[model samples]
Structure formats: C-alpha cells, structure tokens
Target: MEQSLYLKTAISAVRAAEKIIRRYWDDGFDVRLKADESPVTEADIEAERAIRQVIQEQFPSHGFYGEEMGSIRRDAEYSWLIDPIDGTKSFIRRTPFFSTQVALMKGNQIILGVSNAPLYGEMAWAEKGHGAFMNGHPVRVGKVTTLNNAALSLGNIKTLAQGTGWQGLGKIVSGVNRTRGYGDFCHYHMLAAGQVDLVIESDLNILDVAALSVIVEEAGGVITSLDGRQLGLEAKNVLAAATPELHELAREYLRVN
Candidate 1:
C-alpha cells in the first residue's frame, strides 16, 4: 500500500477504535492492572482488536506494535504503532482525556500520526511535509517566544518527582507564563493545537508518545528528552515545546536543579 493509503487506513482505524471506546466511555468493564500497575480494561482490548483488524486486512504487509498485544514485524518498510487508549486509568475513571494514538514509522522514523479523543470530539493528524490538523482544521505551534510568556504543561508530575524530583518543575513553573497539569498526553494535543507552549513528560512508554512526535513536529514544534536527546521509543522522558527557546529553557531546567 502507498503511504497515503496506509495513513488513511490508520486514521480510519483510530476512528473505528474511537467508536468502540465511546461505547464504554461511561463505564468500562472489569478493569485490571498490567505488570507496570497501569490500568487496562475490556474496552482497551476491544479497541485494539478493532484497530488491529483494520491494519491486518488493509495493510497485510505492514508490521504492528500496540499496547494490548505483542509486537509483529515484517520485512516491509513501514510499521504501525498504536495505543488504543492512552489514558486507560483516566478512561476507566470516566475522564475524557484518553485517546487512541497511531503512528506510521519507516526506517526508525515516524512519518505520520493520528490522535483521536472521541469523547472530546477532536482528531489531530499529520503527514510528513503536509502539516498537522485538528478536526481537519490546520494546526500549528504557538509562538510565545520567551519563558516569561511561555505556557508550561506537564503529565504524571508525581512520577516525574519520583524520577528527577519536582525541583526542576518548580523552577519551570516560576519562570513560565503559566503552569498547569492536565495529567496525560492531552497536554501534547493542546500543544499541537497551539494552546500550550511547553510540555515536559517523564516515564512514558512508546505507546504514550509515538504519535505525538509526528503531530508536534508537523505542527512546527519540537520534542526532545529532558537531556536534549531526540525522542524515540527508547526515550519517553519528553521535553516538548512550541518553539526552540522554550525547548532550550526546559532543557536547562532539566539539566540544572
């Protein structure tokens, strides 16, 4: 299949999973914990199945890696990475912050991504060089330009404190225009939509951020680790910003106290 066809297939698949997810939005069935203590529910499995079926039927030669299932790789040049419900704990608790994230990667680099927040009724998608869109409307990065005017957002702050300590975040909040904690990748969505300027994440799996890298980059932003390394499945400690200045400031905070 062509890149466009596979991308369309991915968008359709995420939306289809969204439908199944919305069906149990109010109440999920029998939540459980993964070995990492993260929440999972029947809804997660159903959504993954829905997405996997789409990929398998339409892009049989492509590889797949998803949260609910193990990885499958083929000799094909493209792979689809998926997260049926990125915030399952929140979803199980009836929060609307959860999303279905999908990314198409080739040669170790993501070229396309789509994120669907069904309950929120919005979808953000991007293709290499084509730009990003939210609900089909074009989206771009914000241009706060300075730390004093920058909006700083975060997810899993408590976990961040456990890993590197909140002192870094403390400095960031004091230096930024505003600081808010939305507690999931939704902040990244807000970043892609140009609502927020900076987002620092700590301790996430690839499923949490695979699609986000493509969306933010396409939206004219940057996503690197706190240490200034490029974001990859191996690096979940994300430090994302709407502009280069904010990224540098955030990186300095991470490097300092």
Candidate 2:
C-alpha cells in the first residue's frame, strides 16, 4: 500500500481506539496488573482490539505489534505498531495525557504515524517525507541551537537516575534554560509542535515511541536513544531535540565516558 493510505489507515485506527478509550473513561473499568506489574485495564485491551480491527480490514497481510496484544506476523515487510493507551496511569488518574498511538513500519522504517489524544483535543499525523501536522495545521520544531537557551522536558527520571548517565543528565539539566517533566505522549507532541526544544526519557517501549519518533522527525526534529543510537524496536531511552546541533550537544552531555 502507498504511504498516504497507510497514514489514513493509521489515523482511522487511532480514532477507533479513541472511541473505545473514551467510553471506558466515561464509565469506570477495572485495572489489573501484568506479570511485569504494569497496570492494565479493559480500556487498554478493548481499544487495542478496535485499532487492530480497523487496520486488519485495510491490510490483512500486514503484521501487528501492540501493547495489549502480543506480536503477530512481526517479521512481515509491512507491520503496524499500536499503543491503545500510551499513558495508562495518567488515563486511570482521569488525566488527558493518554493517547492512541499507531504507526506503519515498512520493513525497518516507519513510514507513517498517527497519535490521537482525544480528551486533550489534539491529533498529530505524518507520512514519510510529507512533514508533520497537528490538528490539520503544519508544525515544526523550534530553532534553539544552544543548551543554555533551550527548554528541556524529562520523563522517567527515576529510571534515569539508576543508570550510569545520571551525572551526565544532571549537567544537561543544569545547563538548560528550563526543564519540565511532561512525561509520555505530551512531551513528544510538545516537541513536534515547537512548544519545547528537547525531550529526554529513560524508560519506554517501542510501542510507546514508534509513532512519536516519526512525528518528531517529520516535524524537522531529531529523535534517538539517549546514547545517540538510531531508534529501533529495541530502543528504550529517548533523546529528541529541535535541531541537529541541540541533539548533538545533549547527546554529548548524556554520553558516559
């Protein structure tokens, strides 16, 4: 399928998931814990099922990797990544930070993405080489080139403190003009829309960031692992910035000798 079609499908899937999520938001749902001890709810399961149904109708041959459902045909040339509720904890807390994340990956490259935060009333989408959009308006990253003048956002700081890069992160934090902990989809959306200059996260899964990575890059920003590696399925940490110079500087500060 073409990139445009993939983007459309992703957007539709996100909307479908959003409906399910909102329904559970209005009504209450029971939360459960996975073996890993992360929270899960019927909203998560049902929303992911809704997303998969929408995508499956469009591309039955494509593979799927979802936060709620395990991998399906993960090795297929075309695969869809889904996170029905990217911030489940926030969702359970009645916050608007949760979002439905969907991305189409052709081989190892993400070609399209759609992130919908229904309660937040924001939807961002992008097709490879087509740039990025938030609520139908084109968006781009900020132009802050230096750390001293840039605003930074942090996520999962507790996990980051346990790593060897803690001191490095501290240096970057001290140098930045301002820092905020806007965890999960919020920071990525803010970065893509030029509201923030940088975002750093120490703990996340591919499902949490696949769609976000595409949005940031398409918006003229750079996103990679904290150590400056290319984003992949195995990526857990993130270091996204508005410009290449800012990204490199942050990477240098976060680099462990």
Q: Clash totals for all models, in order? A: 0, 0
Who wins the lDDT comparison?
A: 2
Q: TM-scores of all models?
A: 0.93, 0.97
Highest TM-score scorer? 2
State the lDDT of candidate 1 residue by residue for 128-158, as single tens digits: 8888888888899998778899888877655
Candidate 1 lDDT at 115 equals: 88
* Cα lDDT for residue 231, candidate 1: 67
Q: What is the C-alpha RMSD of each candidate to the true structure, in Å?
A: 2.4, 1.7
Model 2 lDDT at residue 195: 95
Could you give me the TM-score of model 2 versus the true structure? 0.97
Q: Global lDDT of each model?
A: 0.83, 0.90
The residue pairs in collision within model 1 are none
